[model samples]
Target: MSRPALEVADVFRSHGPAWRRAHAGHVSLDQLKVMSAIERCRTAALGGHVARCADCAYTSIAYNSCRNRHCPKCQGAAAKDWLADREADLLPVPHYHVVFTPPAAVADIAYQNKAVVYDLLFKVSAETILTIAADPRHLGARIGITSVLHTWGSAMTHHPHVHMIVPGGGISLDGSKWISCRPGFFLPVRVLSRLFRRLFLEKLMAAYAAGRLNFFGDHALLADTQAFATHLAPLRRSEWVVYSKRPFGGPEAVLAYLSRYTHRVAIANSRLIAVDEQGITFKWKDYRIEGHNRHKRMTLATDEFIRRFLIHVLPKGLHRIRHYGLFAKSACADNVARARELLTVAKPEGEPTSAAVDPNKPSCPCCGGRMIIIEVFARGATPRHQPTAPTNRIRIDTS
Candidate 1:
């Protein structure tokens, strides 16, 4: 694929230093590290290998990726590998896409206590689903869920939400059968919403009592106990957002959906249009609108754009994707095996699952031949052997 005309790295490379100076004490260490990683990713600073095509003798330099989870340029390969690992686990049943979103008020607290609140967002949302699905009046089956946290809205604003991909059914309580839901339905959204709101608030209050929650800036008043209770009072009465989409066509469709969402950064390089004196221009979807009008271009001042992006830098070591219920790590293998057996579907053959291209063996653009690594370069070192000049030779930046 052709490189994007512009990238978040380009913006950071040009303005990051100045932005860092301007924000001085406000930026977090994780955000600073993310910026540095993106700037140096796929550059000589990370080192790489030089490859020569076996047939055409074509040569190219492919720099090493920083492999930072927040780097837009690095997620494509990561997502591919993750999807490959998960391909075998997909049940041959319809899957539902459900989203859990806290209101703006709660998002404010999440902004200040990301690690704590985001953890609750994942835990509480999963618990809510598990509770609802296991109720006798509901599906009465213990479902599995793969949840991914997304912290940015289409416009790069801080909108924390969890996207869950759930198999339409689960194993019965007795472990005797594979229980499936109605063809198009999963769980009641209203029930999920109310339970999520109550459980999240209860957990949030517990966290506050334990001093795990922090308050700063405009929320400093929330540090007081009474003030905090008052803050949460309105939220208890308000409705939280929980919605489910139509079921996917099949397991392939579910895998395709997971591929796009699993490793996505806050913004992708492809979404960037240009970086200029007028600031950064990028595509954003205004969900409040309908039809083609929802797709629009937005421009933000460089400083503001950088600030918005940094707001989404999650606390270090916090996981963005997690598995719950049957897919949980403790029993995933045995559970998947039982699920396949109950569904009466044969286990997928043990074949090579990954289709990601090996960076060390690139295809020759000229003759489609496998390229072998001719030389390795260390960090901050350039390749010693350059490709010889030939009129027909094409130079490619495989990085």
Candidate 2:
């Protein structure tokens, strides 16, 4: 794909220093590191390599990626690599997409206490599904889940939620037969919503009692036990948001959907229309509106844009994508094999399951011959030969 005219890296490189000075001590170390990495990504500051076509001798420079999970330029390759590994695990059964979201008031608390509350969001949501599915009243089988946490809405606001991909059925409790939900349906949304609300609030309060949550600035008053209880009182009666989409058309559709979401950053370069004296302009979907009118454009001052972008930089070492139940890393292989066996379906055949070509190796643009790396360049070093044309740029549409 061709390079985007503008990028987050460009915005960071131009205004990041001033933004850092203005924020001073308010920015977290993780956010600062993200800014630095995006600014240096695919630039001479991080070095690169020279690759030449064996037949035509055409040369190109391929800069090294920062490989930061939050970098827009780095996630396409990462998602592709990850999806390749997951392809073999997909079952022939239908797959469902379910979302779990907290109320705005709860989101406020989550913003203040991200680590503790986000962890709760993942655990409670998974537990809710597992508990409900295991009930004889529901599916009565142990289901597997792959959950991905998204912390931003289309406008880059703090809207924390978990998106789970679950096979339409699961292994029976006794591990003897495959249990599948009724065709065209997964589980009842109302039951899932009520249970999720109850469990999340219960655990959130417990986290507060254990002194694992923190409040600051406008929420400083929540530090008090009575104030916290009063704040949560209204949420107790309100319903939480838990909804499931219609099952995907097939396993191929599921793979296509997962590719788009697995490694997304706050915003993609394609969504960026312009960055000029008027501020940063970008496209966003106003979900409140329906039909064609939903797509809209908005602009924000450079400082505000940078601030909003950095709001999504996750805490260091927190895993955004997680697997639970049958998909759990420890028992995934065995469990999947058993599921295929019970279903009486053989593993996908014919084509090579692995990616046909390594993304790191590119075909020659001039002669369609293999490109071989001729030299390695260290960080801050320039390559011996500059490319006659721009090298392939990885593009991911995160919007």
Candidate 3:
């Protein structure tokens, strides 16, 4: 297929050199490699083939996709897989998206202790959600939660927050009946905010005491325990920010939202609008508006763009997607089955064959017949045998 009008690759190809010159002494090689990899995601940089359809004789070229976890082109499958996995975990009731933000006091320190503070963000926010929802006075049922960590804002600013997609219902404590939370709202956002603040600060202090949090570079100021304690002092004085968006329409809506977050890094490819001799332009969502129309365009220097992009490159091996309470990965499946039974809901059993029949977008290969799978390769392994038509099939060219 033809490339998009203006892609990350086009931006990199046109302006990457200028960015390198401007930031020669500043940026690291690893960071540049990541940018290059993202830009070159599904082009000739990675080899692919031109397939010819046998039925229609349609000729088309298929380029390879990067499959890099951080590449925007590669996320469709990852999101699909994750959504499928979460499908069975859905409760009969509506689901809510919960977001919790650390105070500026903690955000500064979090900048340095990304891996640590981000970990705290997930654990604390999740505990707050499940704990508050479990109260007999509230829902009286445990809630299944999937929390994703986002450490950057539209400007690539280090604004750490947890985006939690929670099923409105959960399995009973005894795993017998399906417990459901209120439809319109779950836990009170204000209450959740305070509790989240307390849990996060308490745990953060524990990390500081145990010497688990890291402080360096721009964060060197927070290294001293006294300074760190002071940094956290204001948070105790003010309430933390734990905001819950209105419940999604249903499970499918939840998947659509989760798809946007699951494989995303700091930014998405669609965000980059242009790369000219001057700088780069991007589209950023301004949540201040009433709805999605709140999003607007933004511009940044090439070097600044690169810098912001790298800020979110998570510490390697840290898991950003986490399951909690009834949705905990280890035991969620069995629990979901029991919950479905109690709710009297017949859960979908999924499609017959899941071996992604046509993983790629439909292309007209240059052949008389439609192209179908002749050989299957598990990953990059060479195909053992390929299907071929009687007339077009070439004999084994052993000679």
Candidate 4:
């Protein structure tokens, strides 16, 4: 049997009692229920049934998933569906993934403004790329960008960053031919950093003045105007960190990269190293790159694990994925069509096949093939198994 995942429900179901006892006064009852739901997804607690294929007579045990945005089990189909939708819009050009991180000094202020700061991170980074790329000296075209907000570092710390996947080029404002950037480079990191810092700071200041920002107990110092201004002063002087990765190997690489990032919650289930009475143990990547085998296993107490996991839960109704420039919803289809026409790039054919992917898609776990959708029977319904019609009785041996 394959290794089982250390699910949110696992932590909640097995360890939730300890967490609730520890945080008796702080956690609401509804919060506990949400935790339980995420933990028990795809298990018997929530219930499941068997599904049969009409064409092939193959049956599968289909367990209902939580469908919570934070559930790792649900993200696979979400990512696949999302990628399917974006496939129609892929530009026939190279694409790059860029990341922007706030410095420690700024991150202190950012901790208090997770909602606001994270939103600014998306806007500033996407806007920074578009503004710079559209310059005459640069690519000078409007680019398509899809960005995701990530708030946790490898160690489950509050390190926030934005990951952007961008098609290598864009169309000029006048809707002329597709413009391509230098093969390896997308935009200058130094330039993007400076612009991003300025744009974000300006917007932060606006949010502060509008009183959309919040300051808690220790961070109340930021509530004062002078202190807030002083806090931003050093960031103004210091160089911001806006880093860009080199262009993807090819279009397939771009899809593979998206398959990994999009719809991914804080951690994948496979990363969990162990779960026992001591607590939950999991492997995490060390980005500092001290060595190739840098993944470390760490265990935590039940309460500590719950605290760490729930800490990353975002405020309700906030969007972590955003589109900008040519990728913006208002004009993406038109712009993508025009750009494709100008570049004379042929559309990729048929559905994409992931080497191995989400359980929901049900492609051959052996060699991947279209697990054709044959039927949809209702709940508690079963098809009558009929006697096989013999080929010998019906057929003449033409061969």
Candidate 5:
């Protein structure tokens, strides 16, 4: 993958401080922290180490990463490490991709009530899929679902949706056999859509009645029960969007898709085109349009672009990726184990290994040897001058 000329970090490093000053007290602390982390990521501001190739005597400086989940530059490694652990969980079966998006009217309400609405989204959508799939009329099995929450559209607009990767078949209710759905078909999207719409609206109204939801700005009038009911009237009648893409070729395809979307931020660094006096320009897809016409560029004032990005910073400690039904964390491992056994496939050797590694460690560019830190330096401090000595360890400095 060739590096893009512009990156999300570049945008923040240039205009972040100015935007912070202008919008002081208006942004969330988490959003401000995200801006600060992105601006300083992999820069001297965060401190770093010097790594040298032991064989050929090549040297390089590697700065520490911010590791913020919202940082575009940080998610790559996070995804890679996460996928390593998930690799063992892949059953030898086809996987389906389904997306459930709330209507624009409900999306507006969800913007203000993010915690409640987002939680409801995951709950209702997962329930809808599980409930409908277990019915004899549909797949007639308890399916596993790995759902990821995405809150932005191609243009960085606030569009909340759940992307689900489901196995093509599931365990029968009696746990006696593996039940597979018809090839090239998962479930009827219309059935899923109607169930999702009805369930989401029901729970949302219940939350409103319990006073667990808050309305602000233009939606403040919805604080009243009658007004809130009236506000949701249109949403109730509107068709919720639920569509499933073609089933992936195999388990490997599912892994590839997970690597891309599971840890993705609202906008990747590669999508950024330019930043200038006018604004920041980036490529965006108009999904409403078709083919080449859908690929277009968009520019927003730097502040507005930052605003749009911040809208996607999820609440603290919220889990964006979740598993439901058979894939539910409580039983996922057991379920995968059983599924593999039923399919007459043996678990791979050394299955379920944790592939976690130190994020700051660097490898030699020429020799590919692990670089060791032989010296310590504080932020902005220069390395000390020392007599050259024959040693295998790579001398390092924070500066």
Candidate 6:
């Protein structure tokens, strides 16, 4: 496939320095770092090395990647590596995709209190699902959940939601057998929605009472206790969005879904149509419009585009992807093994695992030879007669 003509890196490379200068003291250090990383990614600013094909002598200067989590240019390889690590963790059963979204009001408050509110979001959403599924009236089992938090909507708006991938079954409370949810269905959305609203609001009110949340800008008035309560009053009665899609066809489909959903940025390089002096033009989906008009193109001035993108940068070191219940990191391995054994399913033979990679070698495009590093170069240095065909290469080690 042909690479997209315009990329997020191009926009930043051309306009990022000016944006940083214009917003100097106003921008967060994290945001500024992201801009710098994107502007210099896969370029000489970060340094690189030269690789020569053994068979064809195809030599090239392969620049290093910024590997910044927030960079759109850097997530493709990360997603692939992540998927490979998770290959051994897949359960042989149906899986469901559940989404828990904060109402517009909560999202407004969450903007300023990202760390606190987002932490609560992960906690409450997972608790709600696990709690409901554990009830005798519901599925009555201990389910596994993998939730990924997304802070932006299709139009790059501040919409916060958690996307969870869950097995349609769980271990029995007695730890004797696997309990399967009915085929094609998971939990009831209405039940999940109601409980999610209560749990989130109750916890949020506690956070407010304890003074853990910070309110600023137009919401500054919320610093007052009474005002905060009044702000949450309407939301308490409103429905919080919680919905689940039909079960995935099989484990393979679940992997495919995770590959796209997890590690996704606000937008991809391929989605960008054009970048120029006027602004950026990219495809955006309008969920409210419905039908063919929903997928349409929109243009934003350079400044506004940068603002929208940075808003989703997230608090530094915050984990956007998380695991809980059976999938929780602490004991997921033992639990998964037990569940698989209960289902009388042995781990599939030769499950297409990723081989141990050699970081120093680059494969030859001409005759598929293992190309080795011939020389290393420092940051901002130019190589003499560097080959550029094949377009992409990875740099390993510095001389």
For residues 3-58, write the lDDT of model 2, one tens digit per residue. Answer: 78899999999999999999999999999999999999988788888888899888
Please estimate how well model 2 matches the true structure, expressed as its whole-model Cα lDDT.
0.90
Q: Score candidate 1 by TM-score against the native.
A: 0.97
TM-score to true structure, per model = 0.97, 0.96, 0.85, 0.84, 0.92, 0.94
- Worst ten in a row by lDDT for model 5: 390-399
Q: Can you write out model 6's per-residue Cα lDDT over 1-399, one digit (the tens) per residue?
A: 234578788888788888888988989988888888888888888888888888888776777889998888678778878887777788989999999998999999999999999999999999999999999788999999999999999879899999999999899899988999988889999999999999999999999888899988899999998898899899988888998999998888999999999999988887899887779999998888969989999899999899999999989878999999998999998988999899998876664445545333647756878787777788998876567455464332221
Q: Which ten residues in a row have the lowest lDDT in candidate 6?
A: 390-399
Query: Sort by lDDT, best first: what order?
Result: 1, 2, 6, 5, 4, 3
Residue 348's lDDT in candidate 5: 68
Highest TM-score: give the candidate number. 1
What digit string (tens of lDDT, one per residue) describes model 1 on residues 245-289?
Answer: 999999999999999998988889989998889899999999999
User: Residue 57 lDDT in model 1?
Assistant: 85
> CA lDDT of 29 in candidate 4?
52
> Each prediction's Cα lDDT score?
0.91, 0.90, 0.72, 0.75, 0.85, 0.86
Model 4 clashing residue pairs (backbone): 9-39
For model 3, state the Cα shift of residue 188 in Å. Answer: 1.3
lDDT of prediction 1 = 0.91
Q: Write candidate 3's Cα lDDT for 1-101 as tens digits.
A: 22344665666666677877877877666567767777666555654544445576443334466666666567777787777776666765688888888
Clashing pairs in 6: none
Better of 2 and 6 by lDDT: 2
